[model samples]
Target: MLVALALLGVVCLALGGFSVRLLLEQRRQAALIAQQATQGAALELRLKELGKRLESYQRINVRMGEELGELRKQVANLPERLARLEQRDPASLSFSQAARLAGMGASAADLTQACGLSQAEADLVARLHRGRPQD
Candidate 1:
């Protein structure tokens, strides 16, 4: 009976040691799990913020694309608009006026100042369009 009691005490001591080790391990594992959960939550928040920023960038890019398309359309119409403006400009009629004045015996200086012709342009028109001298 004394031997049996000693054996039982040894077994109980072993089991107590094992239970303490298991409890400490469980606590350590729980702490690690809690740390991992915190990290995961932080990462999730960062990802959501990045997604929102990406959406904002996409919206800005779309607006810029629309503005670029409008600019392209305006650029495309510039040449035709310039042509119309040139047609309506009074300077376009200067050469015809110079020639008519030349034909009516106007002097080179008169065409140059009156019709905005350069000296060379006035002299050429005077020579080309002047009337013949009366015989």
Candidate 2:
């Protein structure tokens, strides 16, 4: 009977040790799982932030493309207007008439002052005024 009790006590001690070891292992595994979950949440937040920034950049790109198209249309119309203005005759008028037809304003004095022209130069401009004359 004494030997049997001693054997039973040894078996109980072995089981208690095994249970403690298993409990520690379970706790370690749980801690590792929690850490992984935290990391995953952080990664998800970062991904969302990146997605928002990408959307903003895409919107800006689209707006810029629209503006560029408008600029291209305006550029395309320029040559036609220039061609019409270029076809007018310059030498057929008196100096004052020539200046008026050339889109120089009604005030010849003001035009001369603004252009820093001598009287002779102003008279020459009136005499040989051309449409869209070069600076």
Candidate 3:
């Protein structure tokens, strides 16, 4: 009976040591899990912030695209507008024709109205080329 009791005591001591070692290992694993969880949470928050920034950039890109399209339309019509301006230019009139009209008794007002000359230009032509009567 005494030997059997000693063997049981030795077995209990062995089990107690194994339990303590197991508890220590569980504590280490739990600490590692907690650290990993904290990192995961931080990463999730960073991902959300990055997503918002990406959305803001996308909105800006869309607005820039719209402005680029408007600029393209203006550029497309530029040649036509320039051609119309060239057609309306009054500088195409020659000075000799204005002088000849003034010598034919045309008034300064007539020169301006009929020959595309400016008022000052018509007046100068009239002064230089007014008809002279034969003596």
Candidate 4:
């Protein structure tokens, strides 16, 4: 009977040790799971922040595209305006007509303003007129 009691005590002690070990392992597993949950929450927050920034950039790009389109339209009209202005003849009016329109008696400044000619162009026109022999 003494031997049987000693064997029973040893079995009980082994079971107690195993139970303590299992409890410690369960606590360790719970700590690991909590850490993983925190890490997942942080990753989710970062992803949300990245998504917001991407949306803001997309809006800015759209606004810039609209501005660029308007600029292109304005640029397209420039060539037509330039072409029309180039078609005008600056020397169509005779010196007498230019003098009359300028309200001066054939003066160089008056002719320049009347015919929309620069000073150099008016001087050239005057020289050409003088070179012509009077009929």
| TM-score list, all predictions | 0.57, 0.55, 0.58, 0.57
- What lDDT tens digits, residue by residue, belong to model 4 across residues 1-135? 999999999999999999999999999999999999999999999999999999999999999999999989976765464344335563664544543443333556766776776675565445444434443
How far residue 21's Cα lies from its native spot in candidate 3, in Å, is 1.4
lDDT of 2: 0.65
List model 2 lDDT by residue over 14-86, tens digit each: 9999999999999999999999999999999999999999999999999999999998897676545434433
Pairs that collide, model 4: none
Residue range with the least summed lDDT across 10 consecutive positions in model 4: 96-105
lDDT of 1 by residue, 67-100 (tens): 9999899667654643443356555447666667
* 1-135: candidate 3 lDDT, tens digit per residue: 999999999999999999999999999999999999999999999999999999999999999999999989966765464345335653886556666787889899998888887887677667666884322
Model 2 off-target regions past 4 Å?
A: 79-135
Of 1 and 4, the candidate ranking higher by lDDT: 1
Q: Judged by TM-score relative to the true structure, which candidate is superior, 2 or 3?
A: 3
Model 3: CA > 4 A from native: 83-135
- Model 2 error, position 70 (Å): 1.2
Residue 70's C-alpha lDDT in candidate 2? Answer: 96
Off by over 4 Å in 1: 79-135
RMSD of 2: 10.1
